[model samples]
Target: MDKQIYDEMIENLYWAFPLLKTKLVKPFDKEEKEKENDLTGTHMTILFMVKEKGSICISEIGKHLGICKANLTPLVQKLIDKSYIERFVDDKDRRYTFIKLTSVGEDFLDNKRYKVQEFLKQKVSDLSEADLMTLSASVAGLREILMKIK
Candidate 1:
């Protein structure tokens, strides 16, 4: 990429990230709370990771989430306390603890996600078809880049 374009991208990110995190992004979190799906962003993310993997080792989860064991222990405990997740010992190795989402957790994630989708649909109802397509493409590209870096 040319220097001018690179500079503009960096400048846009500087301004856009905070706005999206605080204003655009936070509303979904807030709505999840209203639906009684209250969980910290980190916790929610961990739950989703476990949900995706079906069952995953505690250490592997910590690694994926970039949380050390000390901090991860409490977070996992919180999820347990909320009954959103459960831990089990691996049948082959009792020392290995695996984490998995409870059915309640899956339902909560799905319902909250639906609400967020509806909200987004309404918010973008004013945009023209082409603008919406552009926005969709941009978001997909951003997701791809984030996955690579993370």
Candidate 2:
């Protein structure tokens, strides 16, 4: 890629990130209080991470989240206490421990995702048909381009 095109892409990405965060991410976190669990973003992130990996060892999760195991223990424990996740020793090794989301946890995440989708739908409901089409295509293109990175 030409340096000029690269620079423009970097700048566009920088601006795009905050726009998406404020429009999508922040609202989800804000609406979380509706459930009364009062879970923080970190808690939700860990839930999502476990969901993505199916099951993940505690130490690996800590490394991915850049949190120390000492501190991650309580967060994991909180999830366990809420029955949102379960911890078990790896049967073969008896050394590595892993956590996985429970059915309740999956339900909770699904509900939250539905709400966020509804919220975004409401926010865009008044857009002109042409603008909505444009936005949809833009997002599709953005995803296609970004997926090439890895």
The model with the greatest lDDT is: 2
Candidate 2, residue 120: Cα displacement in angstroms equals 1.4
Give candidate 2 regions above 4 Å deviation: 34-37, 144-150
lDDT of each: 0.85, 0.90
Residue pairs in clash, model 2: none
RMSD to truth, every model: 2.2, 2.1
lDDT of 1 by residue, 98-145 (tens): 989899878877976787789888878999999999999998998899
Residue 7 CA displacement from its true place in model 2, Å: 1.8
lDDT of 2 by residue, 71-144 (tens): 99999999999899999999999889999999999998898789878988988899999999999999999999
Model 2 Cα shift for residue 81 (angstroms): 1.4
Q: What's the alpha carbon RMSD for model 2?
A: 2.1
Which stretch of 10 consecutive residues in model 1 shows the poorest summed lDDT? 29-38
Backbone clashes, each candidate: 0, 0
